[model samples]
Target: AQSVTQPDIHITVSEGASLELRCNYSYGATPYLFWYVQSPGQGLQLLLKYFSGDTLVQGIKGFEAEFKRSQSSFNLRKPSVHWSDAAEYFCAVGHGSGNTGKLIFGQGTTLQVKP
Candidate 1:
């Protein structure tokens, strides 16, 4: 079955530290990959997405991800994490053809920022 997996269920990082969240997808073809962040009470926000073209895609909030077709992975990265970055991060893959806007999301990774 095709699904998304976030190896780490939770992660703790100090403020100003670099962060990297791993995301792997199992699929027949290269599907649309996305990274979303959900704050305490805020809705899910799109951090970045990769469809085609450049492998390294830049996103909002100083976030970026690289699409590795060979490994079927789209890892999210940040140079420095702020306290406000504490929240839940999800990795999702969009359906192909018939299902246009539908997305299959991973369990999610909880981020705990340490001051």
Candidate 2:
């Protein structure tokens, strides 16, 4: 069985402050990982993914994450926050055997931006 979780359902921060989004997962085997961001009523844009090797991964929009096998976590972080960064973030795991894409997503984390 495989499952993904975002520990924080919501996060709020003032502009220019740093940001962090926590994500945890449980998988019977090594899982395919992914992070995606979604703006209001829009499709998800892939931020980054970790399949194997290089525990630390860099992403677009000045974001990065570290994959901890032992901890079963992939946490996203940004040195500074912006009002435009305010949106929903999702963490996912894919164990697709034959299907094209089968991603189990976290409920979602909403970000509140204070200008």
Candidate 3:
């Protein structure tokens, strides 16, 4: 079965420190990779995505993700963190089919920013 796992349930980073959220997927073929961020009392926002072509894809809010086929990982990274960046991050995988909206989400990782 295809699934996504976010090893860390919670992560803390300094306000100006770099951040990386790990995401690994188990699938027979290369699936669509996506990263979403949801703030308190808000809907999920698309951070970045990898849908073929480029291994490294740039996303909104100074975020970027690299797709590694060998490791079956699509990790999200940021050079610097902000207080407003603190939110729940989710890694999702979508099987290439009729609907791209259908995705399997990971448990989710909550990011806490320190002063």
Candidate 4:
């Protein structure tokens, strides 16, 4: 079965510090990976995605991720952390062809920023 894992349940960082959120996936074939952020009581917002081609992808809000096929990982990173960036981050994998836009998401990583 296809699945996504976010080992860290929570992370804390000071403002201006660098941040990294880990994500791993298990699938039989190449997977479409995505990173989304959700604020309290709000819908998810796409941060970045990797459908194909380049291994390194840039996203909104100064975020970036690299797709590693060998490790089956697509980790999200930010060079500088902002208080507004504090939210719940999720890593999801698409069901591939034949499926709608449904995605299997990881448990989620909660990011806390200190001023």
**Number of the top TM-score candidate:** 4
Ranking by TM-score: 4, 1, 3, 2
RMSD of 1: 1.0
Model 4 bad stretches (over 4 Å): none
- Candidate 2: clashing residue pairs, number: 0
In candidate 4, clashing pairs total 0
Which residue pairs collide in model 2, if any?
A: none
For each candidate, what TM-score against the reference?
0.95, 0.93, 0.95, 0.96
Model 1 residue 84 CA deviation (Å) reads: 0.7
What is the per-residue lDDT of model 1 for residues 1-115, given as tens digits with 9 covering 90 to 100?
8899999999999999999999999987669999999998899999998888999999999999999999999999999999999999999998668776789999999999999
lDDT of 4 by residue, 1-115 (tens): 8899999999999999999999999988788999999999999999999999999999999999999999999999999999999999999999568778789999999999999
- Which 10 residues in a row give candidate 1 its minimum summed lDDT? 94-103
TM-score of 3: 0.95
Superposed by TM-score, candidate 1 places the C-alpha of residue 22 at a distance from the truth, in angstroms, of 0.4
Over 4 Å off, model 2: 96-100
Those runs of model 3 whose alpha carbons end farther than 4 Å from true positions after fitting are 98-101
User: Considering lDDT, where higher is better, how would the candidates rank from best to worst?
Assistant: 4, 1, 3, 2
| Best-matching candidate per lDDT | 4
Better of 2 and 4 by lDDT: 4
Q: Estimate the overall C-alpha local distance difference test score of candidate 4.
A: 0.96
